[model samples]
Target: MLELACISKTFNPGTVNEKKALSGVALRLEKGDFVTIVGSNGAGKSTLFNAIAGAFYVDEGAIRLAGEDITFKPEYKRSREIGRLFQDPMRGTAPHMTIEENLALAYLRTAKNQNAFFSRTSKAEKQFFRDRLALLDMGLEDRMKQPVGLLSGGQRQALTLLMATLVPPKLLLLDEHTAALDPSTAEKVLGLTREIVAEHHITTMMVTHNMKNALELGNRTLMMDSGRVVLDIGGEERKGLTVEDLLKRFKAGAGRELDNDRILPSE
Candidate 1:
């Protein structure tokens, strides 16, 4: 559903601080594929995401969604086809808006009307929103009138996840969406992620620093280093791999020891 061809990005080019963030990085994801990415800081994981999300233009190469070439599309234009969740729980939702209001906004994205106002929301629409919120099993449906700012981090992120997939965009981008939550909450959110993705069959790319999660969560795992994808594993191969196995692959792919202690095994 998504493809990146020979994508390369460099920051502060032609200067002393010129840093190559991506170098000829090519990747492809089929429909319904879930990919988890792992890399140390500066390994170009975020850069790859930003390139696809149009945070910045790549120094070279192309980005395509489905069969459309969106290499030069503005971020807002691309957003219509993409749902993104940031590490910050507050980034995707309006804190002052009630839960129903926020959901109405997301629901409108896939509606023919193209404009949404909670004040004018039909009874059936409100019911739909309520049903969607109920799926989270967080009792949010009971509190649809509550302002989102009143929610805890886990609640907000879960709500954000629902909003992102309210209409099922062509691709879902999750950048450590559970990184900020406590372990128990993180596990809940991740479990929710797996359920939602499987139910909706959403094509997804998740960038996570947790090696264990990277292997355990997605259909495919990508290990990146020095601005390039060094190891890509999937299917049965990925299922049989462990954190220690991935570490060994990283050493072989990058020709260096895996030194980042941040890539830890899950408890």
Candidate 2:
């Protein structure tokens, strides 16, 4: 569903504080592929995501999604085809807006309707939002009029997840969507993520710090380092792999052990 060819990106080029964030990184994902990425800090995990999300143009690369070239597409334009969620629960939402309002904006924006910005939600659309929110099992359907700011961290994150997939974009990028919450809440959000993705068969890429969750949650796992993808494992090979096995593989591929000592076995 997505393809990247020779993707390379650098920051502050030709300066004292220069850093290459991505180096000839190439990857491909088929439809409904759930890809989980784990890497130590400065490994270009987020940069790869930003590159795909059109946060910045890659120095040299071509990005194609569902057979369309979006290499130079503006971030706003890509939003129609790509759905993204960040570590911070507050990032994707308008804190002062009611839950229903937030859902409406996301719905209209991706609906690709020319009248999206000016259109008002009909009673039927409001009902649709309520039904979708109800699927979160968070009591948000009844609280549609409540400001998003009133929700707890997990609740808002769940709401954000709902908004992102309300229309099932061609691709979904999750940048540690649950990393900011407590373990229990994080687990709940992760469960919601699994269900939503499966329901729509959304092709997804999730960047996570927990090695255990990385291995357990997705169909494929990618290990990245020094701005390049060092390892990609999936299917039968991935089913037999454990966290320690993954670590050893990373060491072999990256020529160095992963640097993050605080990486735990579980979320």
- On lDDT, the candidate that comes out on top is 2
Query: For model 1, what is the error of residue 18's alpha carbon versus the real structure, in angstroms, after optimal superposition?
Result: 1.3
lDDT of each: 0.90, 0.92
lDDT of 2 by residue, 96-197 (tens): 999989998988877655766614899998999999988888889999999999999999999999889988999999998988999899988999999999
Q: For model 1, which pairs clash?
A: none
Candidate 1 per-residue lDDT over residues 166-267, each given as its tens digit: 889999999989989998999999999999999999999999978888988879999999899999999988888988899899989999976767666665
Off by over 4 Å in 2: none
TM-score of each: 0.96, 0.98
TM-score of model 1 relative to the true fold?
A: 0.96
Model 2 per-residue lDDT at 77: 95
Q: Which ten contiguous residues of candidate 2 have the minimum total lDDT?
A: 110-119
Off by over 4 Å in 1: 111-119
lDDT comparing candidate 1 with the true structure: 0.90
